[model samples]
Target chain A: MIWQLDIMFLVLVVISAIASVNVKDLLSSAILLGAYSFLMCLLWIEMGAVDVAFTEAAVGAGISTAFFIGFIFQTTRRTKD
Target chain B: MKERYPDVTIETVCRLLIPPIQLFGLYVIAHGHYSPGGGFQGGCILGASFIMMFIAYDIGEVKRRMREKLNTILCATGVLIYAGIGILCLVLGANYLDYGILHQILPAYPAKARALGTFGIEIGVGITVMSVMISIFLNIGTAGEHEGEPE
Candidate 1:
């Protein structure tokens, strides 16, 4: 239970985190950030932190994504970095 | 320009799903003692339902259901409920948040009173969390353009 799916989600977390920072589009970056949160939540669940996992899924995946998109509407989507 | 879909599919689906999601959120908050969920999780889910409403339709639709005034009151009320419980316990000759003193008023054992107290605080947490999330989303969504201007 500890090590079974940990490695997979760990890799995913790293990938998504990096991708979120590297992406040029702010919207895409925001979505990637959400994906990172989701993968981290999965890892938390894998480790039996179900409460934390639920929080991450709700706040990270649900609310933050909406905030990001809403911010995008208010601001610009293009990113120089 | 905001994108608007002509079809009613999203609207129909969201209408059907919103009630169930809210019910489940309440259940999570109430059933936290017996299950893995608690106040925070349930509040977030409840907040998400409103957000889902926003995504499915327009902001006006959600505003009609949950007004800005009610939202503001909820944020303050939730925290008040939490602190009020602590104060009540203090007045009851116990330390802050000590629910054992609640047994005097309730007809249950100390342990049961404590459990009931815990549940009360969880409800407070749920209300505050749900309102805060919604408030943050609304503020950031409008970028303060809607602030100080009650409509």
Candidate 2:
């Protein structure tokens, strides 16, 4: 595994994690979290855990993102705090 | 959400995309024993395809295709298949889920029987995961009042 790519994904993951929490719009937060999941998947692949990466891509990035969007539609899109 | 004007582009794109997504999901499940994917991941892919359909169309559309009762029944059936296989292995004079013993009934070698048994359980897991994902989305999206169209 290239250390550069690993570092890149690691930085991106941290940035997305913080951004998602700090975002005022819940929808944007959800999207950012999906991005975080994708980056984590990349890290997993780089570490040779291909099966975990596959699951992260499918459930973490794909299904959970859709679930979050669906949930956002049923509630307020903006955060109270 | 109120019914909005249907976007032809979105509908067309989703219709084209869903089939391939589902096919890939099945491929993942089928090749899971030798590959990086398995039942949970593949089933999530399959469920995500339907969720995409729900997004492009309406809840009524998905409901028409997969009724709540049918979905729930499918969820149970998957678990039943999983348990039945395990119990069958036990009744075959082996420990629970000991698939090597399956060779006695099937016309295959012990090792082949184990692979076949694992494949069967993967299928069961895939089925259960898919239905549960759909059920969760339906309940969350509609707030559990899925008897009729959202108003």
Candidate 3:
């Protein structure tokens, strides 16, 4: 059961990781990055690294998303690549 | 076109939301030893509260509550508290970062004293992390241009 859950989240992380990089809209990519962090935090929690998971949740998912949105505000939302 | 500021509903909701988030951050810091939270986690929550304010209203709104100078001082003060505790242990003729020596003054068992020492350093780390997160986000959000004179 635990291994399956791990595999599921692993797949999701990979999907979001690719999405964040390939998405044409910078804003969408930023949101995807946040999603990626959230999934990573979940994986950490499942592995019993509660403290590290907590830090990842707050810093990666929360602050980083805010930072990315703020950057988007300063620049264009759409990207050429 | 996007509006310059959040709607009234968002403004009211954020105002209501920030306090609870901040309170939870404090709880996380206070319970770090017993729970999954610690300095860095709690600090990030506190920083997110300020960031929420910035997102809802503007940079001016956050600055109105937390002044830049005060923020800078807090960043330094956290580091001072951490180092000061370590130095105090040294002054008492123990190794650095040794919490056991704190029992000499705190009137607690060596084990409890270490726990208290951990709490102190966690608070210091929490403060430093909180201020740094806020500072970095503010600087980046404004592109090195922030309102309000140094005060």
Q: What is the TM-score of chain B alone in each candidate?
A: 0.92, 0.95, 0.94
Per residue, candidate 3 scores C-alpha lDDT tens digits across B1-151 of 1346559999999989999999999999999999999888999999999999888888777788888998999999999999999999999999988999999999899999999999999999999999998999899898887766534
lDDT of 1 by residue, B42-144 (tens): 9999998988887788667677788888988998998999999999999999999999999999899999999999999999999998888887877777675
In the range A24-81, model 3's lDDT, one tens digit per residue, is 8888999999999999999998888989999999999999999988888888646679
Model 3 misplacement above 4 A: A77-81, B1-3
Off by over 4 Å in 2: A77-81, B148-151
Those runs of model 1 whose alpha carbons end farther than 4 Å from true positions after fitting are A77-81, B1-6, B147-151
How far does residue B40 in candidate 3 sit from its true spot (Å)?
A: 0.9
DockQ of each: 0.76, 0.90, 0.84
Candidate 3: pairs in clash? none
B56-140, model 2: which lDDT tens digit per residue? 9988888888887889999999899899999999999999999999999999999999999999999999999999999999888
What TM-score is obtained by chain A of candidate 2? 0.92
Task: For model 3, state the Cα shift of residue A46 in Å.
Answer: 1.6
Count of backbone clashes for each model?
0, 0, 0
Q: What is the C-alpha lDDT of each candidate?
A: 0.87, 0.92, 0.91
Scored against the true structure, residue A80 in model 2 reaches a CA lDDT of 82
Q: Comparing to the true complex, what docking class would candidate 2 get?
A: high
Q: What is the DockQ of candidate 3?
A: 0.84
> Is candidate 1 or 2 superior in DockQ?
2
